[model samples]
Target: MVVALVGNPNTGKSTLFNALCGARARTGNFPGVTVEKKVGRLKLPTLGPSRSGGGGAAEVIDLPGTYSLSPRSADEMVSVDVLLGDAYGTPRPDAVVCVVDASNLHRNLYLVSQVLELGLPVVVALNMGDVARARGTTIDAGVLSEKLGVPVIPTEAHRRRGLEELKTAIVAAASGPALQPVRSLPDAVVAEANALEGWLSEHGCPDVPAYLRERMVLDVGGQVVERYRTRCTGDLPAHLGEVRSRLAEAGCRVPAVEAAGRYAWAREVLDGAVETTPEPAATGSDRLDRILTHRVWGLLAFAALMFAVFQAIFSWAGPFMDAIGEGQGWLSGLVQSAMPPGAFRSLIIDGVIAGVGGVLVFLPQIVILFLAIAILEDCGYMARAAFLMDRLMSRLGLSGKSFVPLMSSFACAVPGVMATRVIENRRDRMVTILVAPLMSCSARLPVYLLLIGAFVPATAYLGGWVTLQGLVLFAMTSLGAVVAIPVAWLLRKTWFKGETPPFVMELPPYRWPSPRNVALRVYDRGKAFVTRAGTLIFAASVLIWAAGYFPGDHTELHAVQAKMENPQVAADMSAEAWDALEERRRKLSADLIADSALGRTGRFIEPAVKPLGWDWKIGVGALASFPAREVIIATLGTIYSLGGDVDETDDGLRDAMRRSEWPDGDPVYTLPVALSVMVFFALCAQCAATLMVIKRETNSWRWPIFTFVYMTGLAYVAALLTYQIGSRLF
Candidate 1:
C-alpha cells in the first residue's frame, strides 16, 4: 500500500514524516521539477486475510507542504498530480494523511477540507496537540472525526505521542471504502462542475478527475485550467467561462466561493467541538518578540547571530577540512609507495584522489551551514528574521525570504541556492538563485588572501587600527556583495520582471528545535551534496588533470622522480649533487606543465587577459581554478615549480610570484595586477560544484551555463577596469 502525507507549512508535517520514517526516508527530486520527493517504507499492523499474522508493508510519500490544492505553477501542480495518481511514475495513493496544526485548527482546516473533498480515504493527524493545549486551544478529536467522517488522531510528532494510533488509522483507512466528497461547494457550483467534467471527457481529456473539475470551476487562471486547455480540443476557455457565468448568475462566484464554502463547513463542524481561552496580554513568545523583532534590537540580534554562524562555518570547519586534506596527502603518499612511477599512478593520485578530496573538503562547511539553518528554522527565529528584512528586500523586487539565502551564500552558494526553496514566489526564487553566486564564499578567501599578502603594503593608519593590507582584504571580501546589488536590480528589471509580492509568513511560537529533525536535515543536505554535486566535481577534476597531464612527454620526469625516491641512489651523492638533481626534477616538471593542453589554452587567452595585467601563468591559474576558486593557489604553486602541495602563504611560492616577470624583465607582481586578480575571483562564478547545484535546483542546465558566462564576463570587465584605473593612479 502507498500513503501520501500532506499539510501546510510549519504544521509539524515534516516532523511527523521524520518520526514515522526515521532513517528510512530517501529524498530525490520529482519527475521534472525541483520539488523534493521523499519516500519511506513503513511496517503496519496486519488486519487483513492476505497478511495473515505478519505485519504489512507500505510505502509513504511525503509531499511538499502546501496551503491549498489550487496550484499556480507547474511545480505546485506536482502535489495535486501525485495525489490524483496522474503524476508520471507515481502510483495512486492508497490512502492520504492530512496533517494539520491543532493550535491553528481553523486555518489549517482550510487545506484539510480540500483534502476531504478528494474522495479518498483520509486519516487526519492532528499534530502539535500539545502546542494547542499550551495555547489554550482545546479540540475535541472524536467530535471532529465524527463531523468529517474520518478518523482523527491527535499526535505530537516531536514527542512521539499518538504515532501508533495514527499508523493504525492509516491502515484501516487504506483498506476501507473511499469517503464521499465533502459538500463544501454550493449546489450550483457542484452541478456546473459535473457538467464541465462531462464536457472535458467528451473533448479529449477523459481522465480529468472530478475534484479537478471542481477546481477548474473554482480556481481562476490556475494551473489546472491552463494544463487542461492544452489537451482539450476546442473552446475550453469558452466552456469554462460559460459554466462560471451560470454559477455567478446563481450567486456562486468562483475562487472566492470555494474559500467561503470551505471555511463555512469548517466553522460548522467545529462549532461545539473546539474551545479557546485567550486572556494573556503577552505570552512568552510575544514577550521575546518585543526585543527580537524590534527594528533596532532585532537587527542587532540578527547580525550577532549571523556573525556567530559565519564564524562557525569559517573557523569551526577548518580542522575538519585540514584533516581531509591531510588524509588526501597521506593516501597519495601510500599510493606512491604501493605503485610504480607511471601515468596510471599519476591518474590515481592526481585525477581520482585529488578530485574526490576536493569534493570531500567542502563537506564540513556544508554540514555546519545546514546545521545552523535547520536549527534556526525549526526554532522559529527564521520567520522573524525574514519579517525584519522584508522592507529592505522589497526594494530589490524580492520578499524578505530572499535575505537568508543570500546571506547563506557568503558561506557557500550550494546550500544558499538550495535554501531558496523557502521562497514561494517563482520570480523571487529565481532572482535569489541568480544573484546568490555573487556573494564571496569561503573558497574565494585563498585567492584574496594570496593577492593582498603578496602585493598590498602593510601601511598603517588611524593609529594602526587599520592597515592597507587589512583594508584590501576587507574590500575584496565585500566586493562581490557590493556588486550584487546592481546585478540583482538588473536581473529583476529584465529577466525576472514582476511585482514583488508582499511577504506574509506565520511566526510560529518559539520552541526548542527537535534534534532528530535537525540531524535529518543536515544528513539529507550533506548526502545530497556528496552524491549529486560530488560526482560532477569529481568528473571535472579528472578532466582537468588529464588536460594538464597530456600532450607532453613525462617519461623523463618520471625517471627523475624515481631516482629522487631511491635512497641508495641519493645516499651516494653529495648534498650539492642532490640539490642539482632536485632542481632538474622541478624544471622538468614545470616544462611538462607549460607544454600541456591547459598551458597552451592559457597562452591562447593571454592576449585577452593582458588588459587585466595578467600573464599566461596567471591566466592558467584562473582557468585551472574553474573547478574551485581556491585551486588557484595550488595551480600557481605548480606553475612556479614549487610543487602542488604549497599553500597561498608558502614563502617559496610567494617569493616565486614576486620574482616572476615578463619577457621585457618587468615584474608581474604589482599592486594593480594583484587587485585585478582579486577582483576577478571575487566576481567570477568559478566553483563547478556550485554550478552543478544550481543546475539541480533549477532543473535546467541553461541557468548554470548562463550564470558561468555572465559572471566570467563581468569578472573580466571589472578586472580590466580595476587594473587600468589603478595602474594610472599608482
Candidate 2:
C-alpha cells in the first residue's frame, strides 16, 4: 500500500515522517527543494503478515508542504497533482495522511477539507497537540474525527507520542474503503465543475477528476490550466473563459469564491471541536516576535547574528583544521616512506593527499555554517530574517521569498539555486538564481582563509573587539553580497523586467531547535561536501597531478638530494653548506614545475590575468579552480609544494609565497595582489556545479552561460580596480 503525507508549511509533518521512517527515508528533488518529495518504507508492527504474501511495509511518500491544494504556482501545483494522481511517475496513493497543527486548527482544517474532497482514505494526524494544550487551547479529537468522518489521532511528533496509534489508523484506513468528502460545494459551482469535467473528457483529456476540473475552472490563470491546455486540443482557453464567466454570474468568482467557501466550511468544522482557555497576557511567540520581527531591532539582530556566525566559522574551526593538516602530513610521510622515489610516490603524497586534504580541512567550518543555518531555520528566526530583508530586497526587484535562497547561497550555491523554487514569480526566481553565487559560499572560505592568513595582519581593530583580519574577511564576503544587489537590479531592468511580487509568509512560533534535525542537516551537508571532494575534486586533483608530474625529468632534483644526503660531505661541511645544498634541491624542484605541462598552461594564460596582479603560478591555480572554487586552495598548495619542496601546510604555503619573487627579483605576492585575488574569486562563478544547477533550475543553458560571462567580467574589473588603487596607495 502507498500512503501520502501532506500538510501546511511549519506543521510537524516532516517530523512525523522522520519518526515513522527513521533512516529508511530518501530525499530528492522532484524538481527542487520547495517541491521535493521524500519516500520511505513504513513498517507496521500490528499488521504482521501481508494478505498479498508480501512484507507488511507500506510505501510512504512525504509530499511538499503546502497551504492548500489550490494551484497558484508550479510548486503548489505539484502537491495537487501528486494528490490527485495526475503527476507522471506517481500513482494515486492508497491512503492520505493529512497532518495538521492543532493550535491553529481552524486554518489547518482548511487544507484537510480540501484533501477530504479528493476521495481518498485520509487519517488526520493532529500534530503539536502538546503545544496546543500548553497554550490553553483544547482540541476534542474525537469530535473532530466524527465531524470530519475520518480517523483523527493526536500526535506529538517530536516526542514520538501517539505514533503507533497513528500508524494503526493509517493501516486500517488503507485496508478499508476510501472516505468521501462530507461537505458539498454550492449547486451552481458543482454544475459548472460537472460541465467542465464532461468537456475535458470529450476533448481527449480523459481521467480528469471533478475536483481538478473545478480547480482548473476556478484557478483560470494557474499552472493547472496552463498545464492542461498543452494536452487537449482546440479552443481550451476560450472554453475556460466561458465556464469562468458562467460561474461568476452564479456568484462564483475565480479564487475569491473558492477561498471563501472552503474557509467557511473549515470554520464550521472547528466551531464545536476546538475550545480556548484564557490565560497569560501574551504568548512567548508574540513577545519574541516584537523584538525578532521589529523593523529596526530585527535588522540589527540579524547583522549581529551573522557577524557572530562568521566569526565562529573562522575561529572555532581552527584547531580541527590544524589537526586535519597534521594528520594529512603524517599520512603523506607514511606514503612517501612506503613508495619508491618516483612520479608515482609524488602522485600519492602530493597529488592525492595534498590536493584532497586541502579541501577536507575546511569541512569543520562548513559543518558549523550548516549547523548555524539549521538552528536559525528550526527556531524560526530565518523567516523573520527574510521578513526584515524583504523591504531591501524589494528595491532590487525581489520578494522576501528570494531572501532564503540568497541567504542559503552562503553555505553553497547548488542548494541555494534549488531553494529559489519558493519564489512564485519566474522573473524574480531567475534573477535570484543568477545572483545567488555572489553570496560568498563556503567553497570560497578556504581561499579567503589562505589568502588572509598569508597577507593580512591579525591585529584587532574597532576598539579591539574584532580582529582586523576577521573584519577584512567579513568585508570581503560583504562586498560579494553587495554586488548581487546591483546585478539583480540591472538584470530586472533589462532582461527580466516585471513587477516584484508582494512577500507573504507564515512565521511559525519559535521553538527549540530539534537536535535530530540539526544533526541530520549537518551530516547531510558534510556528506555532500565530502562526496564532491572524493568525486569531482578528486578527479581534478589527479588530472592536475598528472599534468604537473609528467613530461619532465627529476634527474637533477635526485642528484641534488643525493649530494645533500652524502654523510662524508655533510660531516665535513658547515651548517650553511648543508642549507645551501637543500636550497639548490628546492630550486631544482621549482625548475621542474616551471617546465611541466601545468606550468606551460599557466604561462599561456599569464597575459590575460596580469592586470589582476597575478603571475603564471596564480593563473595556474585560478584555471585549475574553474571546476571547483575551493580546489584553488589545493591547487595553490600543489604549486607552492613543488616550489619550496615543502609539505602542503598553511604555514609552509604562506612562507613559500612570502619568499616568491618575479623575474626582476621583486616580491610577487604582495598585500594588494592577495586582496585582488581574493576579490576575483569572491566575484567569479568558479564552481561548475553551481552553473549546472542554474541551468537545471532555469531549464536553459542560456541563463547559466550569461551568469558565467557577467560574473567573470565583474570579477575581472573588480580585481583590476582593487589591485591598481591599492598598489598605488599602499
Candidate 3:
C-alpha cells in the first residue's frame, strides 16, 4: 500500500519518515516537475506481524512538506491530491497521520479542519509534544481525543515519544472510516454549484468542488469542458454556460465566507484540551530569529558562513584530493607497465583509470559539499537563508527558496534540481530548474580550475588578504548568478507565467541537529554521487582513452618530441624494450590520433575551432570529455606527457602548452584561446548526468533538447564574442 506522509514544512514529518524507514528512502524529482519526492518503506514497528505474513512491507511515501490544502503551489497540490484523491491515480491514503505542531495548535488545527472535510480516516499526531511541555503548555490528550471525533495522540517522533499510542491508532483505523465531511457548506453557493455541476456533468468536471466551477469560469473564461472526448466522464446539461453567464451578469465579486460552525466546533474541541503559557514576551523561535534572521547581521553571517564552506572545500580537501589524484596516476602507471601493450591495457589505464579517476578527484569536494549543505539544512539555517534572499530574488521572479537549490547546484545540478522539491510552487520550481544550470555546477569547476590555474596569476590581491586566483574564481561565480537573474525573469514572462508562490514559512525553533539524522542524509547523497561517477565518468574515461590511444603514427616529428620530453632511460633495455619504445613513440604523435576514429573526427572539427587556437589534440580532448566535464582535466592530464607535472597551479600544463605548435609555430593556450575555452564551458550544457536529470525532471525529450540547443548556441556565441573582444584588447 502506498502511504503518503504530509504536514507543514518544518513540522518534523521528514525526520519521522527517516526514523521509520531508514535508508530505503528514494530521493528523486517529481514526474514532470523539478520538485523532489522522497518515499520509503518499513515494517509496521508496533504491529506484531502481518496476519497473512509473507513479508509484505507497508510502504510510506514522504510527500513534499506542506502547510495546508489551499494548494498555492504544485508541490502542495501533491499533498492535497494524495489526501483527497482529487488528482488522478492518487489513492486516498489508507490512513493519514495528521502531524500537528503542538506548540502552534491553532494554525496547525486549520489544516486538520480542512483535512477532516475530506472524509478520510485521520489520526492526529500532535508533534513536538516535548517542546510544548517544556514551554509549560498543557495538552489534555484524552479530552482532545474526545473532542476531535478522531483519535488525537501526542508524539515527539525525534525522541521516539508516544509511538505506542500512534501505532495503536493507525492499526485500529486501518479498516475503519477514514474521513467524514464536517464543514457544513454554504446553502446558496452549494445549491448553485450542485445545479451547475449537474448541468456540466457531461464534461470532465466530475466530482469537482462546487465553488471551483464559478472561479474557473471567471479566471479562464471557459466552461468545465473535458480536455478530450476519451476523458469525458458523462453527459453535460444544456444550460452549463448559462449558469456561468448568469454569474457574470450579476457583476459583483463575492468573497468566500467560512463555515464558522465547524471552526467553532474545532475551537470548542481544543479549548479545554490545549493551553500554552500565556504569551511569554519572546520565546524559542522568536528569540532565535531576532539574531539569526536579523536583516543585516543575518546576511553578514550567511556570507561568512558560505565563505568558510568554500575555504574548507578548496583548502581542507586539498590533501585528500591530491592523494586520490596521485593514487589514480600511480595505478595507471602500474597498469601500463604490467600489461602487454594492447587494447585491454589501454582500456584499463587510459580509459578506466584516467577517465574515472579524474572525475573522482572532486569526490572530496562532493562529500564536503553535501555534508555542509545537509548540516545547514539540518540546523534549519538553509530555510532562513531563503527567507533572507527572498526580497532580492522576488524581483527576478524567484523566491529566497531559490537560493538553496542554486547554492546546491555548486556541487551538482542533479541534487540541486532535486532539492527544488522543497519549493512549493510549480512555476517557482521550474524556474529554479531552468536557471539552476547557470549556477557554476561542480562539473564546470574542473574546467574553471584548469583555466584559472593556467591563465590567472596566483598572488596577493587587496593588499594580500585575497589572492588573485581566488578572487577571479569568486568573481566568475558571482557573474554567473548575475547573468542567471535576467534569464530567469525572461523565462517567467515567456513560458512559466503563474502567480509568485507565497513565501511565508514557519521557522522551527533552532536546536542542535541530530548527528544520526545528518549522517544518514550525507550518506545517501554521497553514495548517489559515487554511483553516478562510477558509471557515467567510468564510461566517459574509456571513451577518452580510446580517442587518444589508437591509430599509432610513426612520425619523426612527434617521436623526437616524445623522446625529448618523456624519454624512457632504463639501463636494462633490450631489443624487446626498444621495440616497445618505438611503439610508444608512434603512439605519442599528434597524427596518430587523427588516424583513430576519435582523432579523425577531431581533425574534421579542428577547422571549426582552429580560429580559437585549439589543435586536433585539444579537439580530441574536448570531444572525449563531452559525456563528463571534469574528465576533461584528466583527459588533458593523460594526454599531456602521461600525467607528469599536471600541477594545475603555477606553470599549469602551461609549459607543455607553450611548447606546442601548429605548422606555423604558433603558440597554444594564448590569452584568447584560454578565454575562449572558459567561455565555452561557462555556457555549454555538457554533462551526461545533468542531461539525464533534466530528462527525468521534464519527463520528455523536448525540454532537454531545448536546453541543449539553447545552451550550446549561447556557448558558441559567447565564446566567439569573448575571443574576438579579447583579441582586440589583449
Q: Which candidate is the best by TM-score?
A: 1
Provide the TM-score for each candidate, comma-separated.
0.95, 0.83, 0.82
Candidate 2 local lDDT, 1-730, one digit each (tens): 7789999888878778878887777655454333556788898655543332334678898887878887776667877878888667777787899999988888888788789888888999999887787788888899989888899999988788999999888777777766766554676777887878767878879888888777787776777788788888767889989887887887878768877887788888888998888673577999999987888888888888867876776678778888998999899878865655677777888778876785576577768777887788778787787788889889898877787677767766766776675565667888899899999987787788888988988898778899988988998888878888889999999998756756777888788988887776677667655664335555656776787766789977766655665668779988998778766766666667667887788899899888888999898887767767866665665566434333324687888789989899999898899999999999998876677567655656788789999999999999999999999988
Residue 582 shift from truth in candidate 2, angstroms: 3.7
The residue ranges of model 2 lying beyond 4 angstroms of the native Cα positions read: 31-35, 48-55, 86-91, 181-184, 197-206, 277-281, 355-359, 401-433, 440-477, 491-499, 532-534, 553-581, 610-615, 627-678, 687-707, 720-730
Per-residue C-alpha lDDT of model 1 across residues 252-344, encoded as one tens digit per residue: 877789889888988998988999885734578889999999999999999999899888988999999999989999999999988878899
Superior candidate under TM-score, 1 versus 2: 1
lDDT of 1: 0.88
User: What RMSD value applies to candidate 2?
Assistant: 4.8
Clashes in each model (backbone N, CA, C under 3 Å)? 0, 0, 12
Quick one: RMSD of model 3?
A: 5.3
Residue-level lDDT tens digits of model 3 in 1-730 = 4456777777778777777787888776555544456768766544433222322356677777766565545566566656756545445566677888887787777677767777767788888887777677889988887778888888877776777677677655554544556553344434556676654565554666643443333222222232212345543333445544564455422222333433555677778897877765465767778877899888988888877876676677788978997899789778755655556765787677766675576567667766787787777787888888999889888898887778767656666765665676667877888777777775677677778777767789678899977876786656556778788999999899866756887777766686767777878766656664346555655665665666564345333433433435544567787666654654464345556777788779988777666787777777766776665664565456435234344353666666777788777777777778877777777765565456656556676677778777777777778788887888
> In model 2, how large is the Cα lDDT of residue 352?
86
lDDT of 1 at 417: 89
Ranked candidates, highest lDDT first: 1, 2, 3
Instruction: Compare candidates 2 and 3 on lDDT and give the better one.
Output: 2
Error of 2 at 282 (Å): 2.4
